[model samples]
Target: MTPQRWVYLRKLLSGFPSFPSSFSSCRPRVFSSSQSAADNMAEEAKKLAAYSAVDNNVQNNHVVGVGSGSTVVYAVDRLAERVRQEKLNIVCVPTSFQARQLILKHGLMLSDLERHPELDVAIDGADEVDSELTLIKGGGGCLTQEKIVAGCSKFFVVIADYRKDSDALGQQWKKGVPIEVIPMAYVPVSMTIAKHFGGEVSLRMAVSKAGPVVTDNSNFILDWKFEHTHNWKEVNTAIKMIPGVVETGLFVNMAQQAYFGMEDGSVKVRKAPVN
Candidate 1:
């Protein structure tokens, strides 16, 4: 399905009683006052990385791909700020419903793959980033669309805080790799992945609602908790080969660069090795 159709279908299904607005509401809540100092530092670091990347890459009359998640929130905010200050002509392509809302909320020009088939750059957030620049994304359940937009872009950049920057995929993010699958095939898909990958597979359940977490594409999520390391590129290919699997969170060799927001207010940049 086209990206635009996915957005429309998500909007339609959102009104159903089975699907709650927030899937992870059962997760422990943290108030701003009760948040630790380190949390505050991470927030600032995210903003610093986002602002720096935008200043360095985004230019006038560029088609940009806006990714989903919390860190991308800061990136969109900076994009809006730049648009206001420099009056840059930027067209944004959203990877999810949240991203589309962000583009509309910030009053930025919103386009799609049909209108702009090729993007200048795509900036997204990752759950974990290893030394080789391999990524584990879709922590927010937008993997399918996020992958599509990133693949279409000439340069895919990742932004994250220090907490998300790790030496390996499972070092920091313990939730495992998110795999979007057709709702009816989740059980079989889970079994197939666990059999092949030798990792615990679980259907991602929603906290606010009584069913599984639904993606913007009206699909279910299966998180594969891998215990050992393997060739990520091979694994990504293998998972995609499975039936009913729409997309996997394993992003291997896709990002051209990554900007990590450090605790000391430094932005560390990593680029993919030239082939």
Candidate 2:
């Protein structure tokens, strides 16, 4: 992760209109020229944060947890470059099917939790990160595995564009907290969350496909668009206590650090607030 190496990588990506193949298809549509420029700026910011997080946190011979989404795509690219130049012997543990594909596409060595139960670090992307380092993840439908990997890692780091940094959870990301549940219990779970939390509960539907989006673990997602904010920690615990709830997107106080790529071309680092 040398400065020269980063510059070279940045130059390589500067001309591309989209990110890596991992998420190029899902990026927002640009209507006007001005809107296209803004999209490119956001993509650049994501690359900067991803590179900075990988450079500062990853070490040789470390077992790393590769997270899902667009930001993690750049992290995987940087890791692959370091493996080629520095000859690092790092093992990658993917949090989802997309993560696994990214690892294999880049020719990185891939392992599983069965082989490496402990991890040195886990670098992930979040939908939103509050001041306390509480994260709302699972935008890519990988929340359950992402939380498990982060819980096992010694340190969890988040990378996002400046837009995702917020004072509170729902301020920036309006998609609400994604809740993965058993397929059979979706109706009851939605009703219960609405009764207890007071939010509009919608079953996440698929874009390209006909029905709902199925998770890697064969579960359905319930995106609870909460209206008011409460004690996030308590809400997270209460939601998980539900019988059919597999996992929630509410990552309360899990991240140790977060890197946000700003519009000013500088990467801002935020450490977890001490309790």
Candidate 3:
């Protein structure tokens, strides 16, 4: 797709119904003092717009993949609106616990990934995204399932705010790339990340609990901080080669398009070049 067309498509895809219409009456108003709240509203609007654009292009009864994270909350809301409006008949599949909650709370019908092996579209959020549309995901600890859903879907749409788009993936998200691994592999993985990968890595510890952070799948999480990432594909491949590594946050060539909300109340979309 041409760059101009990509932007146009993004605006259309991210278009969503207003909050009060999709979500229930309990929808929280944008807090005047909270930047996060405002950002969330903008993000949600962009996500809805993106969903609408894609929904119109597809036939009825498409199975959709819903991803985890705060931004994807809006995506779920949009999907629910589509269902409520009867504009679409779709079986929604979730990537994690939070995603499931959004589906349930929004009153959308849910389906299992096992039941619907082929998904038409998957909507998700990224921790960071490079210019080429490569992403660093899993910040909410749902990378494994998110990747699974995205891999199975014919189109993967990522929704994020302006902060997520970057010159490079690692440069935008400084919290480090979240890596899910077997609990027993934490120490070994940490060693490899530091020695072989030449970066500072640390086990993510739960502030509320004494042990390391536990993922939705009962695995442990490691946050690896690389001072410089010259080759993201190589780094991602190397991490995947390690034993006991369940999944890395690095999402290379998975997204077909992205919608980012600007501070000025406008939304921008970017589409990957057609192969």
Candidate 4:
């Protein structure tokens, strides 16, 4: 569905304490009360992409999957707004602890995979998105759950800022693939990945805390920078086979569509080729 139109969630939105405006046909515009907030083009772009995804994909009472990350934060906010404005009875499945919290904070009803295994649609932010729609997620350290939700969804819609769109995944996102591993096996796992792939595999460290990041599932993260790009599907498969590797950030052939908000605040929709 190439719904290229952009529409704001709110028409008269002013000060956004955390996180809209008129649905003017095909163009979406959001204005903030604080000039500083409005000035940040990156954030504005993120909001625009999120709004486009929600307006087009989210149906009333739909079972939705919400993902983690900075851009996705705006997605949750918009989803909540839709729920409130339309009084929609939707159940949201969260991909991480943080995602669950965001859902709760916005007063969105929460469920899990065990309860509702099939998601009507899922929206997430991507670290990188290639021309083929291959993605490198897990920058938010929730790859395992995020992948599960996306894979289970009927429609997986990725929302990212313009900076994430690239000809290839490695071109825009140079941080390498994020691999989730068991805490006990991180050292050996990093070494083994480097030995096989010929790139630096570093245990992802935490900036806020003293040690490495602990994911929602209490797993450690390793960022693997491959020496050179190869067939990413093959690379993803090989990495998943390594012992103690829970999941890789590589999202191969998962996304059905994507919305990239450019620096000029325009959203570009990419659709996978149909068989």
Q: Quantify all predictions' global Cα lDDT against the true fold.
A: 0.88, 0.92, 0.78, 0.86
Which of 3 and 4 is the better model by TM-score?
4
lDDT of 1 by residue, 1-275 (tens): 45643453445434434425486662333222224444566787899888888888899999999999999999999999999999999999999999999999999999999999999999999999998899999889999999999999999999998888888889999999999999989999999988888989999999999988999999999999998988999999999999899999999989999998876567899898777
What TM-score, over all chains together, does every model reach?
0.87, 0.89, 0.81, 0.85
> Where in model 2 is the C-alpha error above 4 Å?
1-31
- Cα lDDT of candidate 4 equals 0.86
Question: Residue 126's C-alpha lDDT in candidate 1?
Answer: 92
- Looking at model 4, the pairs that clash are 6-28, 10-20, 10-21, 11-21
Stretches of candidate 4 above 4 Å error? 1-39
lDDT of 2 by residue, 156-231 (tens): 9999998999998899999999999999999999999999989899999999999999999999999999998789
lDDT of 3 at 111: 92
Across residues 1-275, which tens digit of lDDT does each residue of candidate 3 receive? 45644454445435433455565553443222244544555555566545654454334688888888877776676667767787677788999988888888987779987899999888888888888898988777899999999999998988887778897767779988889999999899889888887878888888888988899899998998888865877888899889889999988888988888765556778887666
Greater-lDDT candidate between 1 and 4:
1
> If the candidates were sorted by their lDDT against the true structure, best first, what order would they fall in?
2, 1, 4, 3
RMSD to truth, every model:
12.1, 7.5, 8.8, 8.7
TM-score of candidate 1 on Cα atoms, chains taken together: 0.87
Highest-scoring model, lDDT: 2
Q: State the displacement of the C-alpha of residue 170, model 2, in Å, after optimal TM-score superposition.
A: 0.7
**Roughly what TM-score does model 2 have, to 2 decimal places?**
0.89
**How many Å off is the CA of 54 in candidate 2?**
0.4
